[model samples]
Target chain A: MKSLHAQHHPLADTGYQLTVLTQAEVEGAHQPLFATRLREAGLLPLRPTGITVMQVNVGKMCNQTCRHCHVDAGPDRTEIMTRATMQQCLDALRQTPIEVVDLTGGAPEMNPDFRWFVEQISALGREVIVRCNLTIIVANPKYYDLPEFFARHRVRVVSSLPHFSAVRTDAQRGEGVFGRSIKALRMLNEAGYGVEGTGLSLDLVYNPSGAFLPGNQAALEREFKQRLVREHGVVFNSLLTITNLPISRFLEYLLDSGNYESYLDKLVQAYNPVAAANVMCRSTLSIGWDGQLYDCDFNQQLDLLVDGRAPQHIRDFDLAALNERSIVVNQHCYGCTAGAGSSCGGATT
Target chain B: MEKATYYNPADLAKFGNITEWQPEMGRKFFDYYGEVFKDGALTEREKSLIALAVAHAVQCPYCIDAYTTDSLQKGADEAQMMEAVHVAAAIKGGAALVHSVQMMNKAKELSM
Candidate 1:
C-alpha cells in the first residue's frame, strides 16, 4: 500500500484534489457486500424520506489537518465555496422549504465570507447548524470572538472532540488541539451557547480515533458530560458520536496500516437492519462547495452525485424531482448503518 | 467426515451460524445474549470490559477476540483493558493457591 499523498492522477476539473481511491476501490474492501446486506435486511432501492436538512460543504480549507479527516481539509487547500455558489445554495434553500441549513468545511469558519453566509442563512429564519472545529476559534486571534458571533445569530454549533482526554484528541487532530478545544468550549459556555436556558445549542461530535464503529451514543454522551464537567468545568448540551466513513485521509490510514479489509469486515458483520433503514441520506440533501448535489456529504466527497436525471446544480434545484430521485449509495454506506449507527446529527438507531 | 474443533477464533464471527444446527435453541440463546448486552444496570462498555476479563479467565480465544475488540470500541484504553485482564489473572491465581489448604489438610490426616 503506497501513500496516496504523493501518488497522482485523476483531479476533478473543479480542481478539487481527487480521491486516488475511486468508488470501486473503496468498495473492493467490502466483505459481506453492503448491497447484499441491505437486500437481506429488506433495505434495497432506498429512497428519500423527504429532505429536511440542506447540508452545505463550504470548502476544504481548515487550520488543522486531522489524520482521519474525511474531507482531507487543511490550511493550504484552496477549494472553497465562492459567494456565487453560496448564493446558489441560499437560493435553493429559499426556494425549497428545507428547514435546517447545515454548514460544514475544513474549518467552515475559515471561509472569507463565512460570517456573511451564516448571517444570510440566519436571516432566512431557518435554523443554522455550523460544524465548527473547536480549535479554529483558538487557532487564530481573529477567530477568537466566534462564540459571541455564533451566539448572536443563534446558530447550533457542533464541534469535534475525538476524546475527552488530551492524548486521544491530540492524537487524532494535531498536537495542541485538545488544549485549544477545551479553551474554545469554555469560550462557547461564556457566550451562553451551552447554557441551560440560552436557547443557543452547543454540541460535540465524537468519532472513533481508529477503524471501528462508534459506541452507543447515549452511553458515550454521559461519559463525555461527566469527564468534561468534572475535569474542566465545561458543559455542553449534547454529544454526537459519528462513525468515520472510510474515505479520504482515513482510507489512506486504513490502507497504510493494513487494517482496511478487517475494518471493513467488522462494519459489514455489525450491520444493523434498523440502522440501515434510518440512514441520514433519507432526510438530507447535501450540497458541495461547488454547488454539486449529493445524497450525503460522504457521497459529495467521493463525487457520487444523486441518482437519475435530476438537476445536479443548486441553481437548478427542483424539489419535486430531487425528492423523487433515488439516493446513490455504495459499500461505504455500511459505516453509517453499523452497530448503533452513525450520522451527521448522531447515531441513527 | 471431520468433527469441528472445540475452539476456533475464526468461529467467533460464525456464532450466529449456530442456528444452522439447532435453530430453536440457537435463536433463543442469541435472543437472550443480545438482551444481556443492552444498557441497564451496567453500561455496554462496562459489560464489554467484564467480558474481556472473563474471556481471559476462561481462556476462551473466541471470547477474548470478540471482547477485546468490544472493549476498545466501547472506549476502554489499553491500560484499562490490560488492567482488567490482570484482575482476572489475580483472582484465578488466588483461587488456585487457596485450594492448597485442602491438600495440606489431606496430608495431615493421612500422616496422623
Candidate 2:
C-alpha cells in the first residue's frame, strides 16, 4: 500500500489535519478544545520541564506502510537526513547534558548513514534508542546482523508489534509481517537482547488495531509476555502502549470510515489531567530530518514547529530559550494526553 | 433539533448523570459496581469478559457497548470476547431446550 503522501491524499496535508482537529464542533456538537482542557488542568501554554531527550527523525523512508502510521512513511518516501544535519545533531548533543538520543524513521536503518550515526551517538556516551520496526531486521540478508549490531552499541531496541495474532497484526500492518516479526524476535532473543540479565533492552510496542484506545499498559505487558512465551516462545522486556494520534494516514482512516467525530469525542472524553501534566513533549525535543525542530514527533508530522521564541533548527541549539518557550499544541495532542498517556518509552502515568 | 429515539447513543455518555437526580443511591450503586469489577480471585480482565458475556445475556445495548470497550481495554482479545458471547448463547439456548422432558411427558399423558 502507498503512503498518504504517495497517493496524493488530501489528509496527507498537515494543514488540513490541523484544521479538522482544532475545529470546536464536529457534526454540530461541541468538540472540546485540547487547549481549554489543558487550561482547566492548569496547564495551558504547556512549557517544557527541560530537554533530556532528543528524538531525531533521520528520514521518512520506510519499508512498510502501516495503516495507523502518523509519519506517513513508506518505501517511496525520499526525504532523508543528510550527514551534515546528523553532524549538527551530534554537535548539539555535545553542547548539552542530554542523556538519551532516540533515532526514528520510516526505518532508521533505511538511512544510509544509520550505522555511522549510531556509532557517533554511542561514542558520545549517551543512550541510543532505535525505534525499529522488527520486520526490518529480517527484511533482507543485508539487515540480518541488526540484533548483534544493536547489541554491540547497547542500543535499546523498541519495535511495534500491534498484536501477537497474525490476523490482527497483519490487518493493520501488512501481510506476512507477523511471521517476519517473530523471526526477528527469535534472532534478537538469540543475541540476548531481551534475556534476563543482558542489559541489551528489546522492548515491544503495542498500539490498538482499531480506533479504540489501548488497554492498561502493565496488564497488556503481562498478557503479551504470557502469550508470546507460551505460543511463539518470544519474550520482551516490556510492552509500551501507544495511543494512535489522529493524523496523517490515521486521519485519513478516521474520515473514510465516518469515525472522525466519534474518535475525537472518545479521546476528549478519556482525557486525563495527570497524563496531560506528564506528556513527553515536556522533556523531549523532536528534530525533523531537515533539522527543523518540533515539540514532539506528532507535532513534527503536522509541520508545527516549536515556539518561535526558541531556535527553529537543531543547528542553533539554544537550551535555555527552548526550555522557556511554550510547546506548540493542537487537537492531536489529545492522543498523547488521553488515558494513561503515551510516549516513546511508554505510559507517562 | 434532533429527533429522539428509544435508545439514544448519546445517552450512554450521560450515564454518570443519574446521580444528579438521586445522588445518594446513585453514588452507592456506582461505588458497588466499580468495586465488583476490581481484581480479586478473578482478574479484572476475567471480570470484564464475564461482564461482557452477561451483557450479551441480558441484551443491554448500553452494557454491550460499555463492556465491549471495557473488555478490550482490560486486555481481552477479539477471540476471547467472541467465545464469551458464545457461552452466553449456549446457556440461553440450553435454558429453553432443557424443558423438553416436561413437554414430552405432557404429550404422552394427553395421548393416553
Candidate 3:
C-alpha cells in the first residue's frame, strides 16, 4: 500500500479541483444526492442477520468529551440505564444463546449498575467485552478498584487510546487525559489485563485525530506496541484501528474545519465492495440499554430501529425474527464499507 | 512577541499534520484516501456531497475545506449543500438535546 503522505501532500497535484462548500450549501444539496448514491451502492436499505452479540449502551455519561467521540459523551450527560432496563438485559441474556455481551456508554463504568450487570453476565458464563474509556478507572476515587473487579471476571477490556503521545491523545480527548489513561492502563496491566501470556485480553482502539480514515490496522498496531512499551511501559494485546464515522461530534469537526468533501470522497473512493459484504452489522446485533435492537452501534445512536415483523425491543426479542430481519442502513453506511471497512471490532475485511 | 492567542484557521487547516510523525501511517492514509474518492457505487459528485455533510458532522476544518470545494465542483448548488449541513447540525444538536429527557427525569427524582 502506498503512503497517504505521498498521495495527498501540501504541494502534490492530484488533478482534482478543490472547492470550499459551506454548511448550509452542503446540507441542502449534497446530502440528498449522497443518499441516492447509497441506494445505488446496495446500501440504502440494510438488513440484519442474527443476534450474536448483545451490545448494551449503558448511558451517555462520560468523564471526557473528546472532539471525535461518536457518542458525544461528557461529564454533563446523565442518560444512564436504569436498574429496570439492566434487568431486561439480564433476562434476555438468560433466555438467549447470545455469545458475547458487549457493554458500552459514555464510560460504561459510570453506570451505577455496571458492576451488577457484569457480575450477572459473568455468572452466566458468557464472553463479555467492555468498551472502556480507560481514564474512568482513575477519574473517580471510587473507581480505583475497578481493575481488580474486571480481572476477576476475566472481562475483555477494549480501551480507547487515540495515540500514545500526550499531545495527540490529549488534543482529541482533553487536557491531561493521556496522563490519566496511562495510569489506568498501568493499573489494568498490574491486574494482568494486557501482560503477555496472560489469558486476560486488553485491546486498544485508535481513530484518526483528523478527517481521513485511519491507517492500516496491522501496521498501526505494531507502532502502538513499540511506542507504548518504550514511552509509558504500557502493553496491550491488539490495536483496533477504527475509521471516524461522519456523525455526532466528529461530523461537526469536519464541517467546522472545512474538509467534508475530500474526507467523504476519501471514504467513497475507497469503497470496498468486499468490505461492504462483511460489515459488522451483517453478523452482529446491537441492543440499546432499554433492549431495542439496531443494526450497529452507529445506528443505535441515530435511533434508527431495526426492521422486523415483531417488536424490536429486548422485551420482545425474537432471535428467529431478528435473524431473518433486514439491517437498517443509510448514506452513513459508506463509512463502514469504505476501504478496509470499519466496525467496533476493527476492519471488516 | 506574544503569539496570537486566538484559534488559528491555519492551525485547523493543518490539523492533518498531527499524523506527520508517523510517515508510514501517513502513506497508508493516502492510499485509503485515494481509493475512498474513486468512482464506485457512489458517483464522485454524490460522494462529495456526503463528505460535505459529514464534514459538518465531524467538524474538521481541513475536511470541510476540501469537501466544500469537491461538492461545488460536482455541481451541487448552495441550497443543496447547506441543506446537507443542516441535516448534520440537526442530528448533532438533537443527539445532545434528546438525552436531556434523561436529565429531566433525574432532576425530578432528585428534587423529590
**All candidates: DockQ:** 0.53, 0.61, 0.02
- In candidate 2, position B38 carries an lDDT of 79
Comparing only chain A of model 2 with the true chain A, what is the TM-score?
0.98
In terms of TM-score, which candidate is strongest?
2
| Cα interface RMSD of each candidate | 1.3, 1.5, 13.1
In model 1, which runs have C-alpha deviations exceeding 4 angstroms?
A1-44, B1-8, B17-32, B93-112
For residues B6-40, could you state the per-residue lDDT of candidate 2 as single tens digits?
Answer: 88877998999999999999999999999998778
| TM-score of the A chain in model 3 | 0.88
Fnat values, one per model, are 0.55, 0.50, 0.00
lDDT of 3 by residue, A147-187 (tens): 99998999999998977667768878888988999999999
**Best-to-worst ranking by TM-score:** 2, 1, 3
| Evaluation by lDDT, superior candidate among 2 and 3 | 2
Candidate 2: segments with Cα more than 4 A from true spot: A25-29, B1-4, B108-112
Question: Lowest summed lDDT over 10 consecutive residues: which window, candidate 3 chain A?
Answer: A10-19
DockQ score for model 2: 0.61
